[model samples]
Target: MLKLLFPILVMLGFAQLTPVSDFFTWDRNLILQGEVWRLITGNFTHTNLAHLIMNAAALMVFCFIFKDILNPKKLWGLLLSISLMTGGLLLLSPIQSYVGLSGVLHGLFIWAAIEDIKQQRSTGWLLLVGVVAKIAWEQYFGASASTISLINANVAIEAHLIGACCGAILQLLYYFYTLSTASDAPK
Candidate 1:
């Protein structure tokens, strides 16, 4: 597990070296100018220490939970899904400048929930409920000023939704593949 996550952690560490504003380097002007790489790169960039910490913490927790169940193969699939969905969301977003791992976190949460469901785990629905409620609160009420205060903040709620959808779709595909393969095997 560490082998897979180590490189991401290292890349995130290096990303911290660059100024926060650099993340917005591929903002409206650059996109208009045809620098498309930003759509993908921006997902790796973060604006501040707090942002990095929050994202890193979430990544650690989720990786710990899903890594064992997904194994190396599914881990790679999850990572690929996160990257592709994040980039797709960024490209579709009206907002030109943004940075955070909220999208990936959403993806992980959805993936985990779906996995639990496939395993016939009762906690899966609970987890799904919790995630949905939290997302709803964040989207409708905004981050509570009293509980979690954010400064100079702009939340890309759309990215979170899109990433979750991507994760759910991937999980569905994985579930179908597993079911078909199991059935096809000789008894």
Candidate 2:
């Protein structure tokens, strides 16, 4: 587990050392200027120390529980899918500029929760509860609104919602795939 976490920690450390303005900048400048990579890389770059710490802590906590059941290959697939979908959604947004891992976190939580449920594990129910509560908190309490505004940060609430939806859809596809494959197996 430490081996898997080391690279992420190192990347975060490097991100911290760089000037945020150099890496965290986003806007029409990025879109029209053709710096489209910002759509994806922006999620990895935080506006400040607090933003990075909060996101990293949440990521670590979620990974601890999810890593146990999810093989590395599946985990990579899920992350890649979520990142691609998130970038696509952000590109469609009128806000023009946004950044942060909140959408990915939401996608991960949704995916983990669904995987747990499909396996009929109690942990899935707990994760579902957690994701729901997080959604409620972010929606009503505005806890995320502050960090969301740091750098042309347009909250990308739509992206987060879409990511969760995509995760759930993927879970359904995986479930049906497993079922069909099992039924087709030789007795």
What TM-score would each prediction reach against the true structure?
A: 0.79, 0.76
Best by lDDT: 1
The local distance difference test score of model 2 is 0.69
Per-candidate Cα RMSD to the true structure, in Å, reads 3.3, 3.5
- After superposition, candidate 2 runs with Cα above 4 Å error: 17-34, 144-156, 176-187
Angstrom error of the Cα, residue 122, model 1: value is 1.6
Write candidate 1's Cα lDDT for 1-187 as tens digits.
Answer: 7876777777666766766347533364576677666555566667667777778778888888766685656665676567566765666768767666677778888889988987898878888888878778777877656324442466677677777777787788877899999999999
Error of 1 at 123 (Å): 2.0
Tell me how candidate 1 scores on lDDT.
0.71
Runs off by more than 4 Å, candidate 1: 19-34, 146-151, 175-187
How far residue 65's Cα lies from its native spot in candidate 2, in Å, is 1.4
Candidate 2 per-residue C-alpha lDDT over 42-150 given as tens digits, one digit per residue, 9 for 90 to 100: 6666666776777788778777877787655665677667766776666666656655667777888898888788789997888788777767766576556555655
On TM-score, the leading prediction is 1
